[model samples]
Each structure stands twice: as C-alpha cells, then as structure tokens.
Target: MMLSLFDQFMSPTFLGVPLIVLALTLPWLLFPIPSNRWLNNRFLTLQTWFIYRFVRQLFLPMHRSGHKWAVLLTSLMLFLITLNMLGLLPYSFTPTTQLSLNLGLAAPLWLATVLIGVRGQLVYSLAHLVPEGTPTLLIPVLVIIETISLLIRPLALGVRLTANLTAGHLLIQLISTATFVLVTTMPLVSFFTATLLVLLTILEIAVAMIQAYVFVLLLSLYLQENV
Candidate 1:
C-alpha cells in the first residue's frame, strides 16, 4: 500500500516530527529515567556502551552544529523508539513505522557514514574493507560484492527500519482497527483489542530492542568500514 504523508501541513523543525521538539523536552529533561536505558529488552554489552559513549564524545565538537538540531535529532530517535515500544499501550502510534520519521532517522546516519567514509584516503579505506588472507582468485569477487554492499548500507538502514516497524504496526493496526469495529457489534470482541494489545505490547517491546540493535550495529559497521 502507498503510505500517505498524512501530515504534509505540519512543519517538523527538528526532523519528521509528529509534535514540536520543545513541547516534549521539558518533561524528559525534568523527569528521571534509568541510567541503563532501553524501553525494550536488549543484550547489554559493555562494548556497545563504550562505543556509544565514544561516539557521543566524538559529536561534542558539533555543538556548534546547532543545539536544536542536536537535541531534536536525538529526541527524534528516542521518540520513535519509545513509541515503537508504546504499543505496550493500546492505541498508540508507532512513529518509526511511518516513512517520514524513518527517513529522517536514516538520512543523518547515511550522511555521517559518507562524511567519515571519505575523511581518510578512499583507496586506503577501500583496501582495508576486504580484510586479510583471502583466496587470490576469490578476492576480486569478494571485493566487488563488498563494494556493492557498502554502497547500499544507507538504503539497507532505511529499508530495514521501515520494514520492521511497518510490519509490526500493520499487524497491530489491524488488531486495533478490528477491535473498534468488533466492539460495536459484540461485547466479546470488545476485549479482543485489550488482549491483543497486551500480547502485541510484549512483541512491540522486542521489536523496539531489535531495531535499536540493528540501527546501532549497522551504524557502527559503517564507521568501522571507513575508520
């Protein structure tokens, strides 16, 4: 189905936002959260934590890059991920499932890859990508495949997130949409959305965790290839 850009009239100053950035900021800034954070279940790796902290430090200089942009961008990611898990509640939207939002998330990551990818000698970077010790004959073929795959990383990032989020939302949306229709006709079906919401909520939490892992892993992989 062709997804609609339902809110063409709205201006999202930060990213493909459903609401204004500052509007949501005060609450999170004011409220406290667990320091070890994931609205979803994930494998907690010290490696991932260090890498994330390192990347955040790397971006510190970019504070000149517009504070609003930084805050908005970061918050956009949080909102998406939070909402993805929010199906844990009945009738909440999955913002990431929406193309506008996923595109926003993917674009900056793609740009970051390109910027870093070309920072060093392109030829040297390309050479390192192939790794060490390969069959001489197979090396050329492997290089060709890796080159294509590397070029498509951004597209993969976008498609991966969009597909996963969309599939889950679509499934849950049907359940939700059905609940409303069924409720009018039958009392038994009235409780259906409730039960489905509970089950889907757990699944949604899993999806949220997986998507975050996929996003970060691919992001790290891109940087690893370049640096």
Candidate 2:
C-alpha cells in the first residue's frame, strides 16, 4: 500500500487517544525550570535575556495598559516556538499545523482584545469601523468593509500560521522522499539532492522560529490597537 504524502500530517493516535496532547505537553518539559539560587546557569540566563528583550520590543509602542499582556504574549511566543521547532523532528506531529488548533488559539485572544476595546472605550472601538474624513455617501459602505476586516483578523492569523508551516513541511517531505528514491538509481543526483535537503531543513528550522514570532507579534499589534 502506498501512503499519501499528506499522511505525515494525520494526527497520531494510540488506543484511540490522540497523541497531540502528549506532543503539546512534552515541549514544555524541555524548558529549564528557574532555580532558587541568585546566580543562574548560562542557558537560564540566555532564556531570561531573550524573554526580557522580546517583551520589551513587543510592547514598546503600546500604552502602559497593554503592558499587562506581556506575560501572556511572552508565554505564547515560547509555546508556539517550541511546538513549531519540535515538529521538525522525525515522526513528530505538530499541533499548530492544524487549522482548528490555530483558530482555537487565535480567536479567543483576538476576541478578548476586541472586547477590551469595546468595554473600555466603546465609542473609540466603534469609531474604528468608520474612518475620519469619509464622504457621507461612503460612510455606511466603509463601516461594513472595516467591520468585515476586523472580523477576519483571527481567521487570517490562523490561516497564515497553518499555511506557512504546512507548505514548509510538505516541501521537506517531498524532497526527502525524492532523495531516498534517487539514491538507488542515481547516486550522483541523489548526492546533490541530499545536500539540498540538508540546506532546506536548516531553512525550515528558521521558518518555524520566525512563524512563531510572527504569530505572537501580530497578536501584540492587535492588542496595541485596543489598549
């Protein structure tokens, strides 16, 4: 029986239970726990520095009101980066590659930011649906358009993350399969393909990290608008 290229994406199960739960939980264990001692090891120091810098840059433009989300956003960045990077490993399933999971993460956070804007500054929030200096005839049309755009934010977030990771993984798998097949009949060509595959894998690793940052960064931008 031939397996589909996409079979790699199927959620793994054992005894009828989804292994995604384990996949999701396992990454968290890899992070070093902070120790009680005042001094920290190099790894812990580096982790702390990265988090501090990321949080600072992410919220720099927003008012102090947005600062409250620093921890949530920072934690999300780490969670997503971990998931994305780990998925590159052989035989591992990536939960974030699922649109359902991505939407589940995006929708609630996007809605919360919208709700905060509505509750804290209802007039301002509603004002965003219509632009300043619009002609009278275009006001209603512009409002509807803006409202649709606002509603699509979460969908865009989910789709962007899902699509990028899916494409990268699919490409990697296709190239790898080709490399293995060519090794038997075309050793010379297979050598070059293998080299390309190695480079591609390195690129995928970078993409995984960047896509995670982009996801979190966009969320912070949405929060900035509200707060």
Candidate 3:
C-alpha cells in the first residue's frame, strides 16, 4: 500500500508500544560522557569547545540573574539540534515535527519566564502591557493587544518549529518521489532532479540546526525580559 506524505511525521510503534520515548532518548546516548583525565579525544574536545562557545555567546547580553539558566538553555540547544539532525537520517523519526511534543517543550519554559518576571517584578511585568506615553483613548486597546501577544508566545514557538520542519520534510519527500519516477522515464531529467535533491538536503540540514538555535534563543530573550 502507498503511504501518505504525513506518515513520516507519525510516531512509530512496535508490538503496540510507541517508540517516541526511544527516539527522544536516543540522541543523548550518542554524546560522550565527560572524562576524568585532563586530556581528551579530538571529538570530545570539539564538543566541549562548541558547547562553551554557544553558552558564552548566548548569555553574554543577559544579566547576572539570567546566568543560572545557562545550563538549562545549553542542554536544550543540544537536545533540539541533536533531534533535528538525527531526523535527517534514513528511516529516522523526528519527534519535534509533532505539534504536541513541540508545544510540550515550549509551554512550560515560556510559562516559567513569565512567572519569573511576575515574581521578581510584578510592576514591570504589568507595565509591559502598557507602553509609555500612550494616549488615554488607546490605552485599553493597546493593553488587550499586548496581552494577546504575550499569551501567543508559546504557541508561536511551537508552530514555528513544527511548520518549518514539516515543510522541509514534505519538500524533500516530494522531490525525491519525483526524481525516482523520472529515473526510469527520463534519465536526463532525473539526473538533474537528483542534483537538486542534494542541494535541498544540504539546505534542510542548515534549517534543522537553525530552527533548534532559534527556538532556544527566543526562550533566552523571553527570560531576559523577565530576569
């Protein structure tokens, strides 16, 4: 039987058990644990360097209060990038493509930032609902607009990730399918299509990494507003 294009986004199952848990946990296994010795392999050294640079750059603009989030944000960035890159492999499932999983990740973190803002500076947080030097007539309208925008942050985060990944995957599948069909009917055209497919694959790889970074970077910005 022919499969639907969206079938790739569905969670795989075996023996009546869903494999999403395995997919989510698999990326961590690929990472090497820190060694006790001062010296380490090239791979470990590179990984450490990448993480150090990412954390330093990410937190450079934030206040000291936001420094505590370095570990959480760094881990999140690694987790997301791993899942995204791994999904590019043949026969692999991408959990982030699922809206539920993406929302699950976005909601709590976004809520935490809002809560932190309220707890630390309720007046400042509430002040965000109303901009400075606003006209009396527009005050209520602006407040409503700002509140809606504030509430939409998590939804935007989840949808942005899901839509981007889903679109890229669908495009790749469509092009590959077209290339396969053309291979037998039109060898010359198929060769060119296959070349296009390779370029698209490289673009998708960049998209995967970027989307992961953008996801976490937005979270940090939200935290910056609060902390």
Candidate 4:
C-alpha cells in the first residue's frame, strides 16, 4: 500500500542480510585501479587528476605531518560522495543517511586528531580550552564550555551530514509524490512541479559532492590545528 516518507531512509534487507553492507562496499569497486602501463585510459586519467587536485587543495593549509592523512581523507571523500549520489538513483540505499553510520565514520577520526594533539602538544591542546585574556572568575566556566564544545565536534559532524541528506531526500520524495498526484487532475501544475524536481535533483547532486567535501575538509582543519 502506501509508504511513509521516512520509510525510504530505512536500511533494506534481503533474506537475512542488510543491503547496507553492499552499498558501503560497492563504491570502491566502481573505481579503476591504476595499471602499470605508462599510459592510462581517459577515465582513469580524469579520476587521478581530480583526486590529485582535491588532495592538494585539502592539505594545502596543514602542516607536513598532516599529509599522512591524505589517503584516509581522500578515500573517505570519494566513499561519501559516491554513497550520496548513488542514493539519488532509483531503488538504492544511502548508508551515509544513517546517523549511526555517519557517527561511526566521524567519531574515531575526530578522536584520532584529538589524540594526536594530546600526544604531540598537551599544553597547547589544553590551552585551547581557555583563552589568554579570560577574566579570573570566568576561567573555569570557559574551560567547561570549551570542553563541551570540543566533545561535541564528532556528534555535530554526524548530525550535519545526516540532517542535510535526510532533508534533501525528504524534499525530493514529497515533491515527486505531489507531481505524481497532480499529473491526472492538474497536468500544468504537475509540469511545473516536475521541472522543479529536475532542478532540485541537480542541486542535490551538487550538495552530495559538497557535503562530502565539507566533511573531509573539516576533519583536515581539525588535524591542522593538532599538527
């Protein structure tokens, strides 16, 4: 019968297995592995160039020590963007839309950066909890506030990704349902709604890529501070 809009966000299952397992693994297979040949196919060439540019831009603001995270961050970006774009297609699930998945990805990486900061520069990391010119009475309060903010970064990262994707998907589903309902009784209105859907779809595609970039970019910024 009828499906709720939120139903689309549920992780699908086949037999006893979750399809999310496949969704998460599928993106990596879509990429072509680099061959030993001196020349590569156009797709591989373009892929390599795009990744090179992205890594260069992402790491430009960080110290040399932060460069070690290049591979992890780049892979994460591609993984996220692919998961997001794939979900836009018919009959596919987006793992990134799940809060648990997003937090699973965010928490450890964010923790790693914090740990690195603690390990490398403990005093500096502690200093971040308080500003230099804090009034005598406010130092403890500022430290507590800053501590809470620091702890919330990973939660914020996960929620930001989840909220953005969920909102876009819901909007798309709602508009498509309206367009479908209007097609019989109000063809002209349906046409305009359909056009709007097309434009939103395009915007969603850009949002998919941008959200992925923002996720990794913020992580890199955190790393830069630590390094």
In candidate 2, the residue pairs with backbone N, CA or C atoms under 3 Å apart (3 or more residues apart, or in different chains) clash, namely none
Off by over 4 Å in 4: none
Which is the winner by TM-score between candidate 2 and candidate 3?
3
Ranking by lDDT: 3, 4, 2, 1
Q: Which stretches of candidate 2 lie over 4 Å from their true place?
A: none
Note the Cα lDDT for every prediction shown. 0.59, 0.92, 0.95, 0.95
Model 3 pairs in collision: none
Q: Comparing 1 and 4 by lDDT, which wins?
A: 4
Question: Candidate 4, which ten residues in sequence have the lowest lDDT sum?
Answer: 1-10
List where candidate 3 sits over 4 angstroms from the true fold.
Answer: none
Which has the higher lDDT value, candidate number 2 or candidate number 3?
3
How close is each model in CA RMSD to the real structure? 8.9, 1.0, 0.8, 0.8
Residue 69 lDDT (model 4): 96
Indicate the residue-level lDDT of 165 in model 4: 95
For 53-98, candidate 2 gives per-residue lDDT tens digits of 9998999898999899999999899999999999999878989999
Candidate 4 differs from the real structure by a C-alpha RMSD in angstroms, to one decimal, of 0.8
lDDT of 3 by residue, 144-198 (tens): 9999999999999999999999999999999999999999999999999999999
lDDT of 4 by residue, 3-78 (tens): 7889899999999899999999999999999999999999999999999999999998889998999999999999
lDDT by residue (tens digit), candidate 1, 162-225: 7876666667666766888888788697696769867986787788867865675556555555
TM-score of every candidate: 0.56, 0.97, 0.98, 0.98
